[model samples]
Target: MQLKNKKVLVTGAEGFIGSHLVERLVELGAEVTAFTLYNSFNSWGWLDTLDEKYKKHMEVFTGDARDENSVRKAVEDKDIVFHLAALIAIPYSYYAPASYVDTNVKGTLNVLQACRDFMIEKMIHTSTSEVYGTAKYVPIDEEHPLQGQSPYSASKIAADMMAESYYRSFKTPVAIMRPFNTYGPRQSARAVIPTIISQILSGAKEIQLGSLLPTRDFNYVKDTVEGFIQVAENDKTIGTIMNIGTGKEISIGHLTEKIIGLIGRDVKISCQEERLRPEKSEVNRLCACNKKVSEITNWKPKYTLDEGLKETIDWIEKNIHYFKSDIYNV
Candidate 1:
């Protein structure tokens, strides 16, 4: 559990959650190799925002997660691997479902294989509450049935099962952490929270969104990062899945109104047909049960909804140019 001096590999180190996790790992004193998706622009995504001093400690390697050779190279001498790379946008998945399968499922298989081959200490695979589909029951626990409401969620479900197989068949010391809706600064515009905030911050009087009645259990990015670390530290989490959430639900309509109030705006809410997910594909509700995670690891959420929203608003206002507020992101 002592992270100091340990070498860690973090796939998707350039993403919203992955970037935050990398920062935390650096603070924990872990020697980090950050696996970023290769791009001609040579951008590091949110990792570019990290302090120069912290960036010095992380070695960045850019390559595709689905590339077995690339993933194999990233795994070398790593004591732990946190695999977070995936095609996460549900709307895009309808157009490019194959990419999700290749990255979310096959990419995870590569990580598991390399971990076993290199004898890594553990592998933490990131899952999502979307795998639970529309919540059949409020406060979904680990025992709740998983129903993939979209191709994107289905791919993630496949990846979660793939990680479990590695633990059972190869004893690869894998843990699955399913996070509910995590939102914060540097989040992509494809996500609902960021989309609304970016538009409102850009001085829009009306916000376009999908279904407002769908409720979600939201977790702040920092709190979700802590949950990942706790799972990595606790031995009991091995071969098991844990939920990270605030244990409260908010309808998208209410959330938008709350943000409007926080930003001191009287924005009209508009439901865009193009923005809505397919009737069956839409997850109408999601509320997580975190009792199991709390029992196994000393982890708890630190941010309330209002507090997190304020922070998100501040970030979006400062970086309004980074967002295309006039267009629907996905």
Candidate 2:
């Protein structure tokens, strides 16, 4: 299960985490294919900014993951597939739930079918902490009940179930990698970390945010990517779901204050009504139990919250122009 000289296909490779994964895979000596959403601009999303040294080794295939034909073409001849393509914005999902189902659930089905047909060695399916909703208990484990509070989480739950069924029915070498809140460079402004950092760096005295009471277990992007690699290399991970996260939790209000302190800025926190999720849809708390991943693989979170926030702040400061802090990004 060594990745060296192996062929790997990463769907959504143009995204925040996917681009980083592609870079790491190249560094690991794997032949990489990046499946990006097609556009007339021919944009590779964040991958377009990757250094040539890493980008040169990656083959970019621009296609929609929702299309079975496109997914099959990308899966062909690949030893492993990392499925990450999806519509992830929670607010946007509320407005367009069908799109989320089409992209998240159906898109995943396309990839799973392609992997099954191609007989790929491994397919790492991405899951989210949102599926757990508001935790019924502290330090949620893989077996914790999945409550889809929002359309986005519901779609992901369906996708995860699809992967599980494929593994059981067809013996597809599928491993579900559930990552908690992952934050770092190239993350969209829709996410809380980027939203906070972008606003502060944009010279806003007031930060607009959703619920401040919700607690989340945040993991740095590098740590999450390593978790993916660890799952792929371990044959024992097949047909299992593993959680990747720092076992620590932070409230959004505390996280905002920490970011402000790191940037050495004084800011006012404003909870905008528009930014808030519906009462039932909002996941109030999430804490990961990394016991499964730690006991089974070498994956462990390396960066503390302060450390990761500092890095994210630095990146957002330098790329401040990329964000429109005045507008709430859906």
Candidate 3:
């Protein structure tokens, strides 16, 4: 269970959480392989910006997760595999549901099959709170009904089910790690936190957003990554699904005000029609019941919302040029 010198492959290593996980794995002395989406620019996404010292401990693989051959090659000889690759933008999913099915469902099936064939010691498949849709009750647990209100959430539900099937039929050592509204530096502008921060940093006095009443359990990226490591290291987590969250909820409107206050900005928030989801498609509320993870492993969110937002704002302030605040990202 010790990660030191253990070979770990993280699919979607170019992404926000994946890049942070890759960096943490290297720091833990794990032999890391970063699986990134192939691009002509040979871009490693966020990995391209990692400190030079950490790069020595990492291997970068450029390939599509939808390709079985590539996933098989990446899974080979790995002690653990963290599957995080998927099309995660909710608005974009409405435009191209088929792409979500292909990348999220099909891509996850490829990863699970590869792990099963390779007999990898462990596989951590990523899940999201969006799969639960609008929570029917406060502090939604693992047993909550999954209502796919968006194509993105539906694709994730299918992927999660696929992982479960692999465990039942093929005995793949797979565990699902469902995180609730993860945010931090390196996150895409499609996410609300980044969208708000990018706009504020761009000197926008009026912030455009969707529904402001929807509540969410927001966890910092570092806490979510630690949850992955905790789940992978714990043998009891096999064939299990664990929620990684802070057990707290905040409305989007309040969250926006919090961010604005942190940034010391006077901003007016407006609901944008272009950013709103369909009536039934919108998840109005979500709050995680992280009891399973807390009891099964030593994982808990370490950052408060204020602390995390401060860090995110600081990072975005310095990297303002990377964001096109004037253009709606989705």
Candidate 4:
């Protein structure tokens, strides 16, 4: 289970959390292969921003996760596989549910089949809190019933079920890592934290947002990546689903005010109709019970909400040019 010198392949390595995980794995002396979506620009996504020292430790593979041949090639000879590739935007999923099923569901099936054929040491499949929809109970546990309120959530629910079935039917060494609202420096502007930070940094007097009443348990990206590594390293986590979160919740309205205070700005909140999810699709509350992960692995959130928000604000302030704060990012 020791990662040092282990051959690790991370799907979606170009993404926010995946990039951080790749960097951390390299720092731990793991032989890393970064599998990113193929682009004519040959872009590595967020991984392109990594310094040369870290990049040198990584082998970049450009391919689509939806392609079984590409996924199989990437999984071959890897000691462990971290499956993170997916179409994650909620709004976009609404626009193209079929694409979500193709990328999220079928893409995951590609990885599972590859792992099964190659007999990889382990596979860490990514899951989202969105699959739980609006919480029916406070501090939702792993056993809480999943309610797919949106196409995005439904796609993820299908993907998670596929991973679970692989573990049960084929005895695949797959562990599902479900993270709740992870946000940090490299996160896309589609996410609320980045949306708020970019607007405030862009000197906007009014911040446009969706429903402010919905609550979420946010975890820092670094903490979430740590959970991925810890869950993979622990044999007890095999064939299990672990929730990585802070066991805390905050309303979007309050969260926006907190971010405004951190940015040292006074901004009016404007609820944009286009920004809002459909009434039933909107998840009203989410709070994770980290008991499973805490008991199974020595993992806990290392950053407080305020501390994480401040760090995100600092990063966005420096990288303000990357964001188009005037436009609502779908």
lDDT tens readout by residue for model 1, 1-330: 877788999999999999999999999999999999999999999999999878999999999999999999999889999999998999999999999999999999999999999999989999999999988887899999999889999999999999999999989999999999999988989999999999888888889999999999989999999999999988889999999998999999999999889999878999999999999999999999999999889688999999998999998888888899999998
Q: TM-scores of the models, in the given order?
A: 0.99, 0.99, 0.99, 0.99
lDDT of model 2 at residue 265?
87
Each model's lDDT comes to 0.93, 0.94, 0.93, 0.95
Summarize candidate 2's per-residue lDDT along 1-330 as a digit string, tens digits. 899999999999999999999999999999999999999999999999999999889899999988989889989999999999999999999999999999999999999999999999999999999999999998999999999999999999999999999999999999999999999999989999999999888889999999899999999999999999999999999999999988899999999998888888898999999999999999999999999999898788989888888888888888888899889999
Candidate 3 collision pairs: none
Q: What lDDT is reached at residue 118 by model 2?
A: 90
**What lDDT score is found at residue 167 in candidate 2?**
99
**Worst lDDT 10-window in candidate 3:** 111-120
* Deviation (Å) of 63 in candidate 3: 0.5
Best by lDDT: 4
Clashes by residue pair, model 1: none
Position 8, candidate 1: lDDT: 92
| Model 3 Cα shift for residue 165 (angstroms) | 0.6
Q: List the candidate 3 regions with Cα displacement exceeding 4 Å.
A: none
Error of 2 at 274 (Å): 0.1
Q: Mind sharing the TM-score for model 3?
A: 0.99
